[model samples]
Target: MSRPLDKAGWQAMADTLTARLETRAYIDDRFVDAAGGETFETINPATGEVLARVASCDQADAELAVAHARRAFDGGEWSRLAPTRRKRVLLRLAELMEAHRDELALLDTLDMGKPITSALGDMAGAIGAMRHQAESIDKLYGEVAPTGEEALALVLREPIGVVASIVPWNFPMMMTAWKIAPALAAGNSVILKPSEKSPLSALRLAALAQEAGLPRGVLQVLPGFGHTVGKALALSMDVDCLAFTGSTAVGKQLMQYAGQSNLKRVYLECGGKSPNLVFADCRNLAQVAHHAAEAIFHNQGEVCIAGSRLLVENSVREAFIEHLLAAAESMQPGDPLDPSSFMGAIVDATQHRRILDFIRQGQEEGGRLRAGGEALDGPGLFIQPTVFDGVTEDMTIGREEIFGPVLSVFGFDSEEQAIALANDSVYGLAAGVWSQDVDRIMRVSRRLQSGQVFVNNWAGGDQSVPFGGVKQSGNGRDKSHHSLAEYTELKSVWIALN
Candidate 1:
């Protein structure tokens, strides 16, 4: 394990972030105030301190930004630029991100309470996502359909004008990259609304994008609450699309906002209660146990695709529980700035309390607390890496998305039973099946109802994978070439040439 940054080093990083806050939101390639100079203070969850005062942009500011984006799109300087030119700007943005990786990682850690090591990796992931989309632009080709000799049919993809991206706070920088990269690559104007809880990095990213030669008004950042600014974007008639990543309820509301306004295309990547199934034939129980614990405890279990529900065959239930508990004990929550910390503080006091409420609900409903269930004795917003065994299918913990460091264990007798339990959810975002038997892995993987499945592993994939969910988990996908389609519209044109 690597040593954590010392106190002085952390303080220096904090000072740098504070200086960034002096000029909060980035709109139209400039650091500016909200419409009325309204501002909000974003707190650091790890230290319970004020990290920065960000612009509290609302409907008026959102409208202004949307107008800017609409004008940029209509002007055609950015939206109609050659693919190579757009690609160059995007590559430069990625380069700038790499150059400031350390500062960006530190900003993420202080803003969202993620471990410093994990945050550094997230910065790299963001850079990669940007580069992937940038490099893909020039390779995308239109198609010519086979028509009779008298006629020719062409299928071309065109940008959908102004795109609004409303992202969550859990993976702020990465989520920003996911939406911004594809939208900009497709030659659309973008307005980014970062969650008020963690807006520092997005603000910094907008500034870097401008420095990379993105035309003014082509990309903007609005730092505000979802209910106010998010609603405005969804309700804007001039906006052509809205891409969101958040809760199912909010995603639904955004869809309605689109309907009420211009009927804009809305793409959502929402909630999940993904399952991790372990059969009795698994080759190694210890390795499975270790990864199983990580599937839930990593990122403090704030991931939308976290393996919150663990299903084990009855024959190996006891052994699996033993090893899992041992693994869970090692993932104690610590200071997020520590490079060696496995888990960090919860996002804020509200989220910390919400997780505690779910923990209480788990106990009151009937699940037995096998490992951790209490808050730590500290000033920062911290919670234990909680695990519950003997959890029933109907228990609150088993059915709901806790979005915290809590795991619920259940037992299954047969393959059919495991598949049934896994599919019985409002979400079908992802699932994992662990077994050494190749046939069994294939059989179970085929039966699992999820967008992504992992066999003999958990949460393993790259930016190339098409990621999204089914049922109530929301619609559309993010990442990969598939995501680029979300920001573009297909048109079929037929011409008769004599």
Candidate 2:
């Protein structure tokens, strides 16, 4: 109900957040650059303008970072530290993150083009994840095997050695914490590779980690192109494991490298074409439609588990879609730092152009553009939230992951048809069901092929919830206590005492 942010509000948001923006790269526990002293522009996506020049790491930079990590891990300065002591450092890092929340939040908005409110939410969420991991670290006890008579046996967790984690730009700081929290808790040293599109927050995170007393090399960052830095990490024998969050194509490529290279463990949370099933029932169609619109339109539909595929029962398809189209028209794009802006610019020009091409493809495939079909004329790379009605399962728009604020609508006559359409995609990251019937909710959820399901509303998640997907969406899990194992290795021992 509030009006969009005026010019003064936007300026205030920018002024508050950029005070902590240091135009240096955080590398190997220091805010410095490669030996060649190269730097790259960190752009403000809201305007397609440069915000600052950041350190650009290359292959040599990666080698230095890995060597530093190897020494830190071998010396056991951090890995060998007592769990309680490690907890203190992690807790302190969380505190630091909280203190610098506003700055980091603004940095993400400036660099990634997400709204400032969403950026701040990411900071708060990252700090919460760290605190949760710190609490969980000490609670986890190595197993005591139930031994036969006259036998002693024990099992314990060990750090998985050096990890090279690649994160996407959509949720920079939050995913970084998702990787580092459990990895550090289990005593593994880490080397991070943040997307070149949004590397500022990750660099700031490195500085904060060091200030919190994390040993040098224990947490280092590499910010470079995926073709170079990403492939290096994937193929490095020195790197023990790789955790990545990005497109399914990239995940497959990394898996191939993992298989070819040291057979290092690979964990990924890849793309999704999640389904939002709306069944005809005695409920509020308007409310359900609003929730569905928000699911796919939030963050300009950059979320991996975005409910972009909408399957509505034939009986309610017309009414539901009417409400959906109305909602989509209201999601306007503007400056990210605007306090009242619901929609922000796309992350970069390339992605913006890609989404536009997809929109053209939808029209060619006979899908009707009900609302929001094109990019507006603007200075920043901004795409209005798009919708394609009468979409078929075989259309390219339905099959491919657009990673934008685009939705595909499908009408189904039965529950079986809806489920079939939902499961047809190669992805299975998340799904949502909207029905007032408890029986319908229980039935559809049990058969839905997704890691997370929302019954009546799209549930905003929390740290305690285990989230990840089946199939090409990725392997392993994040968030809950189970994620701890992904960053750890277990060892079993047996001794006979007479």
- Per-residue lDDT of 1-498 in model 1, one digit per residue for the tens? 445567467767777667755446677778888988888888889888887678999999999999988989999999999989999999999999998887888888899999988888888889999999999888888899998899999999999999999999999999999999999999999999999988989888887898899998999999999989889999999999999999999999999999999999999999999999999999889989999999999999999999999999999999999999999999999988777789998999999999999999999999999989988887898898999999988999999999999999999998999999999999999999998889988898888888889888887778888789888887889889999878889999999989
Lowest lDDT 10-mer window, candidate 1? 16-25
On lDDT, the candidate that comes out on top is 1
| Model 2 TM-score relative to the real fold | 0.96
Each model's TM-score? Answer: 0.98, 0.96
What lDDT does the true structure give each of the candidates?
0.91, 0.86
Q: Give the per-residue Cα lDDT of candidate 1 at 157.
A: 91
What's the TM for model 1?
0.98
* Deviation of model 1 at 214, angstroms: 0.5
Q: How would you encode candidate 2's per-residue C-alpha lDDT over 126-200 as one tens digit per residue?
A: 999999998888888898899888888989888899998899999999999998898888788999989989988
**Candidate of highest TM-score:** 1
